[model samples]
Target: MLTLLHTADWHLGAQLQGWPREAEHRKALRALVALAAERRVDAVIVAGDIFDSLNPSAEAQKLLYDTLKELRAALPAATIVLLAGNHDPAGRIEAPRALFDLVNVAGVGTIARKDGEIDAGVHLLPLRGAGGAIEAHLLAAPYPRAADLPILDGASEGSPVVRSVRALYAELIAAARARIGAAPLVVTGHLHVAGGLESEGAERRILVGGEHAVPSDVFPEDIAYVALGHLHRPQSVGRECVRYSGSLFPLSKTEIDYNHGVTIVAIEGAATTIEHVPLPRPTPCLRIPPRGGLARENVEAALAALGLGPATPADDKPFVHLTVAADGPIVGLDAEIDAIAEKFPIRLASLTVERPPRRETEAPAPAALRLSERQPVELFREAFALTHKSEPTSEHMTLFHAAAAEE
Candidate 1:
C-alpha cells in the first residue's frame, strides 16, 4: 500500500489587498506538518505555485526551507516532491538540488532533455516505502513552458501546444510503465485543464499561442491519480482520480468561500481512495451582510453587529469585504466608512457599491467590439460605464487619454 499527501498553490509570501499573509501561511504549514506526522503518509506531493511570485522575499524563502525541514523530520521514510508552476522561477527552485537530496526531497522545475530526447531520469521519481523498497512511481512534471514542449512538426489534430503537452506526458507515461510493472503510477500537472472552475481576479490566464486550457484527455485513463494545480477550487475533472488540491487558503475575495485543504490518497492493490483534510484558517474572511449589498443607511448598524471589540489583536482580526447599496455616487462615502471602520476590529480589504437598475427607456448595450475594431478611448468609456453604471466624465476621459498616450 502507498499513501500520499497532496497539496498545491501554497502561494507563500502572498498578500491580500495589501495585507500580509505570512502569519496565515505559517499557521497552515505548521498544521500540514502535524497532519503528515499524524497520518504517516508514504509520500508528500506539492503540485506547484509554492511562492506567490517568481521573485519572493527573503522571509518567504526562509519559510519554505523551514517548512521543508519540518516535513523531513516528520516523515523520515517518505519521499517529498516539489514541482514548479507558472508563478515560480523554474531554475531557482531546482538550484538547491544538492541540498534537497540530503533530505529525500525531489525538486522538478522544468522538463529536461538529453541529446534531443526527453530525459526520464530527471522527471521520473521513485517512491520508496518501508526498508527502502519502491512502492510506487511518480512522474514529476512541472508547468510545461512553451520551450519545454516538444516541437510537433505538421501536427494538425489539435492545438500545437495541447498536442505537445499530451506528447510529453505520453513519453513520460511510457517510461514510467516500463519500470513499474504493477506499481501504481501517479502524475502531477501545473496547468489549467478544461472544466475546472477558476477563482476570478486571482488566477492569471495562462495562454500559449492563444490556447489557454487543455482538455482532461491529456492524462491517460489507466493512471492511478493525477495531481493538478493552478486552480484555487478543489475539484475532480473528467474522472474521480484526476483532482486539484486547491490553495492553502483564500488568496482573494473571490476565493473566500473555498474549502482550502490538502488531499490524502491511499492506494492498495487495484483499489484507490482519496480524502480531503481541511486546514485551519487563523484569520477568517467575512463579508458584510453575508449575502447581498447592504443599504447605505444600515451600514453603521451592520458594522456594529460584527461584535468585534477594539481590543482584538491585529493578527486575529478577520478580513472584511463590504458591499453597500448605492443609488449613485455618494459624496463623503469613503470618509464616512473610514470613520465607522475605526471603531471595529476587522481589517477592511475591499468595498463595492451596488447601483440601482437602469431606466427602461435607456438603449441596450451595443454588441461587443473586437480588439481590432475598438479604440482605446472607446474601450475605456465602456469599462468605466460597466463598473460605475454611468458614462465616464470629461476629467476621466482626459486622464484615460493621457495614460494611453504615455503608453
Candidate 2:
C-alpha cells in the first residue's frame, strides 16, 4: 500500500489589503509538518503556487526552505515532491534542486525538455513503503507551456495543445512504468482539468491561455491517482482517482470559508481511499456587514460580534473585507469606512465601495467642460461666446469652418 499526502497553492507572501500574510502561511506549513509526522504517510506532494510571486521576498524564501527542512526532519524516510504552479518562477524553484536531494525530496519548477523528451531521470522518483520497498512511482510534472512540450518531429498525430500535454504525461507515465511495470502510479501536476470547481473570486481565470483546461481523461484509466493543483476548490475531476487538494488558506474573500487543507490518499493494488484533513485557520477573515456593503455604523458592531475590536487581542486580529451596499449610492464614501476599520483590531484587506447604477448624465457647466469630445467648431463657438459675451456670427462661423477645412 502507498500512503500519500497531497497539498497545493501555498501562495506564500500573499497579502490581503496590503497586509502581509507571512505569519498565516508559516503557521499552515508548520501544521502540515506536524500532520505528516502524525499521519505517517510514505510520500508528500506539493502541487505548485509555492510562493505568491515569481520573485519572492527573502522572508518567504526562508520560510519555504525552513518549512521543507522541518518536514524532511519529521519524515526522513518519506519521499517529498514539490512541483511548480503558474505563479512560480521555474528557475527559482529549480535552483534549490540539489539542496533538496539530501533529504529525499524532489523539486521541479520548469518542464525543461532535451532531445524531444523530458529527462525523466530527474522528475520520476520511487515511492517507498515502510519495508523499504518500492510501492509506486511519482511523476513530478509541473506547469507546462507549449514550449515545454517535446517536439514530435514528423510524428503524424493530432496537434492540439491539450493533446501535446497529454502526450507529455504519457511519456512520463510510460517512463515510470518502465522502471516498475507493476506498481501503481501517482502523478503530481499543476494544471486545470476541464469541469473542475473553482473558487469564484480567489483563483485566476484560465491561468494557462487558449487550450488551458484539458479533459480529465488525459490520464489513462488504469492510473491509481492524479494529484493536481491550480484550482483552489478541492474536488475530483471525472473520476475519484484524479483530484485537487486545494490551497492552504483563504487567499481572498471568496475563499474565506474553504475547509483549506491537505488530502491523504491510500492506494493498494487497484483500490484507493481519499481523506481530507482540514488545516488550522490561524486567522479568520471577516466580511463587514456580513451580507451587505460596508456601513460606518455597522463596522464596530460587526467586529464586536465576531469577538474582535476591543475584545480581540492584537495577535488574533482578523482580516477585514469591507464593502458598500449594492443598492445605495455610496461609491465616494470609502474614506469614512476606512476610518472606521482603523479603529478596530483588524487587518484591513479591502474596502469595496458600491456605486449606484449608471444613469444618463447631463453635460457639465463651462468650468467642467472637457475638450476630448468637443469639435473645433464647437470649441470656437464656446470661446467666442465666452470672450464676446455672445454667440459667434454666421460669417465668423463660416470663416472658422473655412480655416478649419484648410488646416
- In terms of lDDT, the best-performing candidate is 1
Cα TM-score per model: 0.88, 0.82
Steric clash count of candidate 2? 4
Would you give me the overall lDDT of model 1?
Answer: 0.86
- Range of the 10 consecutive residues with the lowest summed lDDT in candidate 1: 127-136
Candidate 1 structure quality by residue, lDDT tens digits, 280-335: 98688988878878888888898888888888888888999999887655557878
Largest TM-score belongs to which candidate?
1
**Model 2 regions more than 4 Å off:** 112-114, 151-159, 205-208, 294-296, 309-315, 326-328, 354-407
lDDT of each: 0.86, 0.80
TM for candidate 1 is 0.88
Prediction 2 global C-alpha lDDT: 0.80
